[model samples]
Target chain A: MIKNVYDDEVPKVVTIKETVIETPTVKTFIFPFEITEDIHPGQFVMVWDLNNEKPMTISVIDKKNNLMGITVRKAGPFTENMYENMGVGDKIGIRGPYGHGYELSGYKKVLAVGGGSGIASLAPLLSFYDNVDLISAASTKDELVFVEKFKKENIQVHECTDDGSYGFKGFSTELADELLKTGDYDIIVGCGPEIMSYKLLELSQKYDIDCQLALDRYMKCGLGICGQCCIDDTGYRVCVEGPVFDKEQLGQLSEFGKYRRDAAGSIVEY
Target chain B: MLKSNILGMNLKNPLFLAAGILGTTASSMKMVARAGAGGIVTKSFSLEANDGYENPTIVKIEGGVINSVGLASPGVEAKKEELIELEDIRDETPVIASIYGDSEDVFCEVAQRTKDYVDAFELNVSCPHAKCGFGSNIGEDPEMTYNIVSSVKDSIKDVPIIVKLTPNVTDITEIAKASQEAGADALTLINSVGPGLRIDYQTGKPILNNVLGGIAGPMIKPIALKCVYNTYKTVDIPIFGVGGIKDYKDVLEFMYAGASLLQIGTSIMYDGPEIFKNITDDLSIFLEENGYNNVTEIIGLSHEL
Candidate 1:
């Protein structure tokens, strides 16, 4: 029998923490650790937005001054609740910096491609790898996030929208394809819509550029023990072993770009 | 000064943290040491890299938990960093490395690789919820159990080895004796029970990602005690009893049932990391009040009846 690693007690709140919203549906949450600790860019926190029954993975936009910032997109019930109810100085339970993260060494030039809310998870990496070229996409011009945030760093911001309201009237894929054609980047890191990542990974592979994709699988316990966020492959778990997996590894899984599974391994497509 | 032993390596205290739950890293292991645990065993790592199962692998059941963690690990090579770091912690706490493998060769290889870092070794032959060809399959059979344990014993000459057993077997005593004869130094009995499943009535489906899981915590205490009780009658080697033990009373029951030392597992999940301090403090009180000078006096006290 598999042993259960149980830690269910929710820590009581002493003070509420807050993050400023960059867009109407997108906001960043700042968590100052009670204990002094170091967190990396790719490692995520299991944010238990009290209104929901389970925890959700919010991106760590930055970890400095002993505080970790999570960027969230209001898409589902959990995010909606978090957007409406959560504010600065409102406390919520946060556990983890769990799972393997992007190997931030050996690469010279890198590109970060994010779609919609996916840009939040990649912001920290951009800060870490200052040389990164960031391409962000949304459905419309108003939806474009982090434009000012990236401008502060003087990094190149390539924006794309479906309705041609922004810099490019296409998707991040078109921008990424143009960048890949330059043959200057050593690595391509992406997170966002599955199709966007899938297209970027394919393009990277064609150019023989190393690519890493962070997948958003359903999770319960952020620990590897919970099998809720398993990528369908031989011995792959997104929560523990990853949220970040190699593009080659992602290519091997059949359900890489489609629906996800619940606790029972039942696939539910979005 | 706190002389005790498991497998064969002399331990200062019998209170080693069980595998998987809290043994993932050196910091966590160091935290366990600081919390007053005598020793620490690492979460089981496999020879090859395994992502194991996905999230929601564990869930709460009444009195305990039903979990199908699928033995997620960072693979052996990556885990060496954590093992090496344990040497730096300023404690004489003997580190026991718990490892799992599909075959005898893998066990032997990992033993050889990790032998220098740890004081002793635990071949996890009894993970109840492991997939076929891994955990319980090797543990349930006398010959297979013997092979896995003996192979490690042959490879690691200096360190003592403990073959952990699962209670799911119909006759655990036979497997215990087989491990002893095959060169096992001691035995750690009862590595969780039941590839049990809990279904959520509201969802009309199972709660865990893997529908079936191993049951631990208070629910398996009686069965684990029974396994230790039955094995005592057949094996002469000292037993390291573990299962559903939450306090000094539970530890005492194992000692009376024939366990020389005890391991605390699932309770740490329910009670928090302070469980080690709680158990030891309670034990100190229980020992002084019971007119017992030392813990050894109570081993197999139940057999006197």
Candidate 2:
């Protein structure tokens, strides 16, 4: 048997830190793990209360802040517990700075795109670079929370909303695709809904925009052992090899931007 | 402590890491050893290279993982390089080469090629997730299981042969008896259960591309223990128990169920390589506290009643 380092147990707590609630569905829980002294952008930490099964993917927003936080959506049992029960002073279990992050260098101008809760994963990538353009879309203005953070960093911000309650009247993919076709970018980095990321990749491929996507999947074991968070066909375990992959590579995976499974191996409809 | 001989090979402890979880590479096998495992078993490799299944080969159900790795391997020749690397790290820690194939010749050839590098050979004729031509088709039939095991036994020398059996049978003892009748040395009871699959709710698609996978981890622990307990009544050879063993307590249960040794597979994924050390340390304490003289005394202890 191959030796797996991280298993399904709770990891030792490094530190319980805090961040402000930028919005109701998106509050950043800051945790500083002494175990992870050196973590890079695009790497994420799994956070969930011991009483719950839902794991939050907290992006390493500020490695220097000693306060890496995850922005969560009130979706299910785990998140509900995290939201209703968790506090700024409460300590929760954290495992990983796991998964592959975005490829950032060797580009003249790049675009970082996000949708809703997906913005939490892109924060570090945007914070690490100053020359990049930050394009984001949400359901409404109230859902648009990270604009000030992007503006504070002096990163170009393109905001869009579905109901015209914010910036553009359409989706972020539309705005991203238009700018992508100008042949002005070397790479486009994205994370959010699968359809959104998939659409971004589709446009990038059509317009020949080099792109990388931060994938999201359920990870029961932070190490590659559990096989719960496997991506399609590549036989690549997201917890060990990557949560990031090139768009050209993404096209080859059979279950990219997909959901969880039922007993019969069929995709469960939401 | 359980200081016992499996197939005439000495094991400091009877606890081993089972095949397939992290056994694909030499590094992974070495890591399990460093974590206090007495032995290692490589992922099931075949004579030819197989890609296995795509991502989501494993999925989390309530109690275990459903894996359909498709027996992904780099084939025999490439696997030899990994076995050679294992030779450098060779110590009292035994690395059991687990091999599977479509025919008896294929099994013998693989056994012959790596016999010198490994401490023992585990014939994987019972992988539940393997396709139509693979896995249990050859294993379920007593005659075929006996023939394939006999072929490898006839070809390979020195290294003891262990046949890993599937639990998806009506009478596992019959299979064990047949394998022993064909000259098998030792047996590893239970691979995964079911050609199981998981589905994605939103996309209305199967979670794994292969559609069906082997059920492993904690989910099948009860069934595996039953198989070991039942097989012990019929077979005299040592049995290596594998299923969902999370700690030393689980290992003890396997021993009570008639397993001379136990292996940790899916548990490694959840707990990391430290599981070996963690369980060993805990077992030492349990042994001392419980006033047990040795681990061997517990083997089939429950059957005495």
Per prediction, fnat is 0.05, 0.07
lDDT of 1 by residue, B80-198 (tens): 76689789642467788889998999998888887888877888998877888999989999999988887787778898888899999889999999999999888888897988876
Residue A56, candidate 1: C-alpha displacement in angstroms = 1.6
Candidate 2 matches the true fold with a TM-score of 0.62
Question: What does candidate 1's lDDT look like per residue over A1-103, in tens digits?
Answer: 1234344323223234666677888887777664233555667766644323344444544344555666777887777777787787665655566666677
lDDT of each: 0.74, 0.75
Go through the candidates in order and give each one's DockQ.
0.06, 0.06
Candidate 1, residue B69: how far the Cα is off, in Å: 1.0
In angstroms, the error of model 2 at B142 is 0.9
| Poorest stretch of ten by lDDT in candidate 1 chain B | B1-10
Residue-level lDDT of model 2, residues B12-96, one tens digit each, is 8887878876666565576567778889888778777775654445545556677776777767877787688788656778889
